[model samples]
Structure formats: structure tokens, C-alpha cells
Target: MAEFMTETEQSSPVVPHPGTTGERRGRAGGSDAGPYDGQEAAALLERTRTLVDPELRAALESLPGSLRRIALYHFGWQHADGTPARDNAGKAIRPALVLAAAAALGGPTAQAAAVRAAVAIELVHNFTLLHDDVMDRDTSRRHRPTVWSVFGDADAILAGDALQALALRLLAEDPHPASAPAAARLADCVVELCAGQHADTDMERRAPDEVTLDEVLAMSEAKTGALLGCACALGALYAGAGDEDVAALDGFGRQAGLAFQLIDDVIGIWGDPRHTGKPAGADLASRKKSLPVVAALSSGAPAAAELAALYAEPYVSGDAEGVVRTALAVERAGGRDWAQTEAADRMARAVQELSRAVPAPEAADGLLALAEFVTRRTG
Candidate 1:
């Protein structure tokens, strides 16, 4: 793993945005900017919304009355100000990846059915998040109360169930012959997702000393990698891509997903609260066995000892500060450095696989650019 990190680390450099000016600010400054600043990432997100909203609406219309209303609310169809406006519901990064992959495979952006497949993938992603927040006891998401917090847990659970069903239904309803197989792949991905969640919960129950980096990586791949792979595979099939293209895209998605998770782990520890929509060291407070923390423990450093001590205590009032301190310890011990290098490696592999999958230079360039943006974005 260390060799892998060393080999891939230099493939991509994180260039500072021209707008940043290298200005350093206090913790709150990072997220004070609006979610949709006039940046390339925001522009891509806008394009995704235009492509996905119609299909999302159509899918919601097909749902039962209660489910449809809940889904609409979950997607921010109703405004935070209690008015009717389609706000920025979610980032739609995965759907953008799907659409880019399809385009790279010579599919038309106007293919309604392919767009529907993209919408299905986004819905499934959010569905898992809705349920995950409930299971993880997370109260906040996207800087607002989570669905499970706003509605009750039972309602959120039902919403998740309905969304999963809607994902398959959309796939099945597609006139394309490849849709069926794509739907099956999605189902398999969900199974893997559940398996990963179970593993995560089991790890949380075990002694901190018992965890290993390999186990953490396995769980991360299952939880995050599988759905990303499904997104790419679905896109390829919808584009009428060959089996080889689909397989290559699948590999790309897996590597990209791992990179995404690693960056997420980094943010979970040190992310600016405003941009991440969470407090710094949020994962530590939740006692999550994230990749960096696992790496620190496995490396057996002073930071690991501090983390072990922190983990040994029962939940108590005023422990959040202690958790943050322990998280800082992990960062000081080079765990964060290791994880960032790993993220860069995974991203390099994703780019390499995407290049192999699509020989056309223009199409391949777009996909590669999107991959780079995903890992490099600050918020």
C-alpha cells in the first residue's frame, strides 16, 4: 500500500483556484461563501440539475402519494424558507459522473432514458444516505436537520425503501434492453452497501485495538465503492457501450469511489465546518473508524495511544472537545498525510482507467477532468 501511494502521488497536483488568492481565514470563513459560487464545479452542478430534474420529477410522480410528498421534501422541492422553489437539493456529483461517462461512450445527452438512469442512481445514493443518517444517529445533513430528524425515523426509513423501489422501477421501465441488466447490477450494489454498513457497525462495537487498516479499506470499498461502480456501469450500458467499456468504467468508478471516501475521511477530521456542513472532527465525536484513524492505530504511534484512550471512555457531556483533540493527534501523527496520499493514488488510478476505457481524446478529456474535480473540490 505504501508503494502504491508513492507511485501515484505525483500523477496529479492540487492547483489552487485563481479566485482563492491564498488568503487564509478563520474556521468559519471557508463555508461562509454560498453553496453555488460561480466556479467550474458549481457550473457542472447546475448542468447536472438541468439534466436530472425532469427525470427526478417523473419518477416522483410515479410514486404513491405519501411517498411522493416525502421524496419531494427530501429533495428540497419545498424551500427551506417554506416556499415552493427547487433549491439545490443535493450536489448530484454521481449523476454528473454517469452523464459524463455516457457522453464519453458516444451517447447523446438528450437520451431521455439514459438521463432517467442517471436520476435513478442519484435517488438511490440519497436513499442510502437517508437511511444511513437514521442508523448512524446523525441529526444534521447539508446544514439542515436530516430527513430522519425532520420527519421521524420510521418515515425516513419508508422514504428510503420507496426510493430504492423507484430506482429499480425506473430502470425496469426503460425501453432499452440493457436496462434490465443495469438494474440487476444496481441491486447487487445495494446488497454490497448493506454489507458494508453492517461491517462498519460491527467495527464500532469492537475494541479500538482490534481494528486494522486492511479491514477499514475493505469496509470503505464496500460502503462507498460499489454504488460508484454501479453509476459508471449503468451509464455505459445506457450508452450502448461494449462490455469492455462497461468493465473499464466499472473499474474507474471503484477507484474514484475509494478516492472520494478518503477525501471524505480527511474532511471528517479537519474540514471547515461551513463548507462541510458539519463540525470539525465530526467523525471522531461519532467514534467512526474512518480510514485515517485506522491508519494511525495500525501504525502504532503516540497519536494512536491518545486515540485509544479517547475511545476507551464512555460517552459523556463535554467530550466533543476531547474528541477533536484526539483527531488532531491523529493528524499530527501523519495519518492525515497517509490518507491524502492514498486519495491521490486512487484518483490517479481512476484517471488511468477512464483513459483506457475511452480512446476518443475529447470525450476522455471531459471524463478525466470530472474525475480530477471530484477529488480536488474543497466543498
Candidate 2:
């Protein structure tokens, strides 16, 4: 639900260093040194796999016929080639965040249950991706044909439905006494996600002049921020964290989610096709009302006027060059600068929330590292 920056924007020539390395380090410096590199993300994924693979596998096994097989393929649990390759599926970042939050709350007796909760969060995330591809008519994902593109729209929809059900079922299986509350919170998050999606889709249908920055932010908070907050709160709940800690973690998650979405919007515009796996100016081609474009339009720049004019044209009539021109208009109008500043501010707020949380040393370190990694990631 959270929008990322356009990948093509990553290659934009506006190369002003947004923040000094020292400032960045200082922001993350309070915590003890922990793995912040991509490898650390990989390690976290491995840990999560060790904890949830059995349960995920059991859930998959219980599904009927081709539906089960398709879900496995969607998760990268099986290969398109049908060979047994255990590749890095997803980064599993959300689960890692959940675990770190729980661990920070002082070793919960139900660490495994928390891990299961993390898996549910990740599955729900992927489930959205599946449906998103269909709705967006995307052709590829994770360097492969999308389920809709390969198996047809019907199958993709069915798989997404099943995955959503699986996530709820997993949440229901939490062995801790706190599982019920956590499950309820997760369900509420799903409702928020739907609300966000409705806002986003509604925006798409409206005239560009009708959209507002406030609406965009609200949409992002619901679509992207809600689930992330749920992940953090669910972790704390599983660990029997006090209300204060849970609230702090929830604040941290909300800020982190906003930061993540801002960075993603930048990537959507400027990221390299090789790294991001999306075409350059893909958002512009789709005429997406992303944060940067929205900011530029709201700022009323000359280029913003041009962008609005282009967006007013029918998609069938819009050319690739038009898309590229419109994206550049956003950058020239200072949307990029505005987004970068907002991202830094959100990251700072997240750190402040983390500081207030008062997690244990190791868990705090990991959580801080994770936040830094999310804000700083290039791909």
C-alpha cells in the first residue's frame, strides 16, 4: 500500500547529497553496532525462515490442488522451472522488524509465536502484491512473470485470497494468551489497508487538480503505515510489553513507514531498471499520483503546470517521451527535494520514538539498525 519512489528517479542528475554521512551515522549512533548491511537483512530472513517455514509449509500443504502449488510458487518456495531452489525469497524485512520489537521488549516467552506473527505479516504483504499486480496489470515480479501474467487473472486473485486467509489462520494459531488481541489488531490493520486502497483508487479516477497533499499523506498512512504499526504493536503484544512500550513502538513504526514510502516514491521515479525491476518512468506512464508528483503539483511550479497538462491527456494518447518529460518536470519543480527532506524528518521522528521505547540493548540495536537499513536502502 505504501508508494515507493519511481526507480527511474534514482538515475536523475539532481545529485545533491541529501545528508552528510556523519549526520546519518549520528542519527543511528545511539545503538550498539549491529549488522546494517544487506547481508544482515539476509541473516534476518534466514532466522525467520527457520522459525516459520514449517508452519508455512503445513499451511500450504493443507490447501487443495493447484491452489496450494501456486501459493508455493508465489512464495518462491518452489521454482518456476519446478526445480528445488531455495533462493532469497523476499527480504523478510517486516518479520525482522516484528522480531526485533519483541526481543527489545525483554525476551518474550512466546518468541516462536511472535515469529509466526511476523510470517503472517509478510504473507499479508505478499498477498497484497499479488493482487496489486493484477489490478495494476503488471507483467512481472521478483524477475519472473507475475501470477496473473502466467497463471491468468483468476488464479492470481484466488491465490491472493488464499494467502490472506492463511495469514489470519496463522495469527489465530499464536500460542500465547495475548494472541487474540494481536489477531484483532491485525484484522483492524487489514481494514485500514482497504480504506487506503479505496482512497488511492479514488484519487486515480479524479482530476489531478482534485487531489491534495493532505489526502496523499492520509492515504499513505492508512495503506502503508497501518500494517507496519500493526507489526510493531503485535510484536510488543506477544512479548507482554507494557502499554507505554507498545505505544512507543507503534509511533516508531508509523514514522518508519512514512519514511519508507517517501524513499520508495523517489525510487519509483529515478531507480535503475536493473536494480528495481521496473521500467523507467513507470509511474508517469501509469499516471500515478505519487508523493513527489503530488507535491510538485501542489507547489504550483511552472513544470507542475506542464505535468498536470500531460496527466490530463488520455493514457492511450500519452507517449513514453511525455512520461519522461513529466517526471523531469516534477524534479525541476522541487518535488524531489521536498520528498527527501520529508523522508529525513520521518526518520528522525522514528529514532525519537525508538529512544522513548527503552528496549533492551541488543534488541534496541537491531531495531535501530533495521530502521536505518530501511531508510538507506537503494533497491
Candidate 3:
């Protein structure tokens, strides 16, 4: 259910710890002194939207009428009343990773050839988002109401199913040698993602004390890391890379995805609603067993008991004080520190994995920048 938004209306920034990814990047060079930074990532994402949006739109346009309308609405291309709307689809990060991985390995030619695969990956991603919103009961995404909230659950689910089918169909109809393999890989990833989602929903029903930090971490990897890894692997396939290199790219993306999740979990608790498009302490209010929460629950801190007691009681509507206490308990129990430290470690591993495939710093810059942009998000 974690979605990466590139732009946010920031209230306050999340300052990185001394040895964290942001801090290291600063020491290596400031934005003016280095090519890999938020600006580079933003440019890459903008370029990716330009390349992939037309194909994505064409694919959606080919859908049958009712489904097309729902799909268009979900993607922010149209309103519920069928009026044209401004674009709010997303930042196109996953597709950008596809193109960047291809470019890193095999240059512009491979990047150009991987456009179809990029579209397919993006399709699969949006499909997940649609279903996740329904399952998570999230009211908003990308600063707007979610599809299920506006169009109802049945329409939202059917639209998501249609999108998944289109993703595979795009790959199946492609003439590239990598198409079949990419399709197979993507299908496997979908299965893993489903399993992860199941685990997440199941964990929500369990007592907080009954859920382990290890279990939550595993679920997060399956739900978030699997698709990101698949995206990079698809790009490598399109580039005709060797198995080891493809696997390395997959590892890189997976680590980065995990890092992104850790930061997202942190934001879910402490993030500003104006920037995140969600109410403050939404995760705590729902008692979601996020990474930080689980870590806090398992920390054996004195505040853990207080947190568990608070979580044991259902959150009453309008009880803002309860949410505040829960958040403070989590913070005092060391959840915040563990999550941030874990995120930095994951980013480091991501960089190491990226180097295994794209040894040249210049070649790896785009992927690194994207990874940094995601993990560094404060909202």
C-alpha cells in the first residue's frame, strides 16, 4: 500500500543522521558538485513520463468503455463525471528505473527498446495501487480521493484486474526476445506480491505483541521489494545482460525498495497531512503493524508496555489524544531510530549491489539518484 510520491508540499524536512545516505551524499558533493541528486532524479522521472505516458494511455484507451472510464478516473485522466482532468498519475518512478537500468547497462539503444517493457511494469504497478487502496481502505492517494472511495469497490477491483491483464498482454504481444521471459518474471512477481499482501492483511488482525519484527520485515520485502526488483531485472533482460548482472540489478532495486518502505513507515507516523495527503498518525490510529511499530513492540523498552496497552484498545473516532500517546510511546521506545538506521543500511546495500552491475559511477548515477530520491522523502 506504500506509494512513492516525488513532489510534496513540505512543512518540515527529515534531517538525516550523520552517517545516513543523505549525509554521505552531501559529503561526497553538494547538488552543485555532483550529478546524482534530486534534480537529476526529477529530470529522469519527467523524461520517463514523456516516454511511457503515451503508450500507457494508448493501452488504457483500448479497454472497453466502462472499464476505460474507471481506469481513466483512477489514473487522474478523468473525473467521476467523465470530465477531463489534469494529470496526477504519479511520478513514474518504476518506469524510470526500467529505463535507467537499461541505459546504465546498454546505453540509449537499450533504453529506447525497453519502452514497452517499462509501460508494462508501470501498468502492473498501478494495478497494485488500485487494489491496495481498496484493501487498505485508504481514502486518498496522490493528493486525491482513491478510486474505491469515489467509484465504489467493484469498479475499482475490476479496473485493477483489467490493468493487470493488460500488463501481461503487452508483454505477450511484444516481438522482443526478452518479452516472454519478462512476462513470466512479472507473473511470478505478482504471485509473490499477492502473498505479501495477504501476510500484511493477516498481520493486521493479530495482536501487536504476537507479530515479530522479522515477520513484518519479510512481508514488507515481498509486498514492496519484489516488483521493484522485477522492474530492474526486466530492464536488464531487454538489454541482453548476463544472468549475474540481471540478478545484481534485481538486488539493487530490492534493497532500495526496502529502504523506501522503512522511510515510508516513518512518514506514516510523523508526516504532515498537508504533505502526505493523509491524516497525521493515520497508521497509529489504525494500529497497522508497520516496521517501526513492530520494532518498538519488540524492543523490550518500558514504553513498549504502554504502546501495547494503547494498541489493545480500538481507536475511537475523534480521539486525537490517544493517537498522540501512541506515537509518543513508539518514539520513546526507539522505533524511530531503528527504522532510520535500518533505512540507511539498506541504502548502503543498494549502492553495493548497483556497483556489482554498473561499475562506473557515471553509469550508475541515475539508479542511485532515484533510490536516494525515494528514501530521502520526508512526507
Model 1 spans > 4 angstroms off? 1-41, 79-86, 109-113, 314-325, 377-379
TM for every model, in the order presented, reads: 0.83, 0.84, 0.91
Q: Model 1 over residues 1-379: C-alpha lDDT tens digits?
A: 0001111111122211223222222223224442223354456557878989888888877888767767777787764343565564766777877777787785565244578788889888888888888888877665457787877889899999999999998888887877888888889889998998888878888987788899889988888888787888888887888888898898888887887788777777887675545467777877777898888877767777877787677646568778667878787767888887787677667766776777665666545555545555342
Cα lDDT tens digits, model 3, 1-379, are 5788555542221223222434432111122323344778889999999999999999999999999999998888999888999998988888999999999999999999899999999999989999999998989888789999998999999999999999999999999998998899999999989999999999988888889999999999999998888899999989999899999999988988998898789878987776766577999998888999999989999999999999999999999999999999999999988887787677778777788898887888888888777776543
Worst 10 residues of 3 by lDDT: 25-34
Q: Evaluate all candidate structures by whole-model CA lDDT and list the values in order.
A: 0.72, 0.72, 0.85
Give the top-scoring candidate (lDDT): 3
Task: Give the 10-residue window scoring lowest on summed lDDT in candidate 1.
Answer: 1-10
True-structure lDDT of candidate 2: 0.72
| Total clashes for model 1 | 0
Pull out the clashing pairs in model 1.
none
Please tell me which model should have the higher lDDT, number 1 or number 3.
3
Please give the ranking of all candidate structures by TM-score, highest first, separated by commas. 3, 2, 1
**Candidate 2 off by > 4 Å:** 2-35, 79-88, 108-110, 314-324, 359-361
TM-score, structure 1 vs. true: 0.83
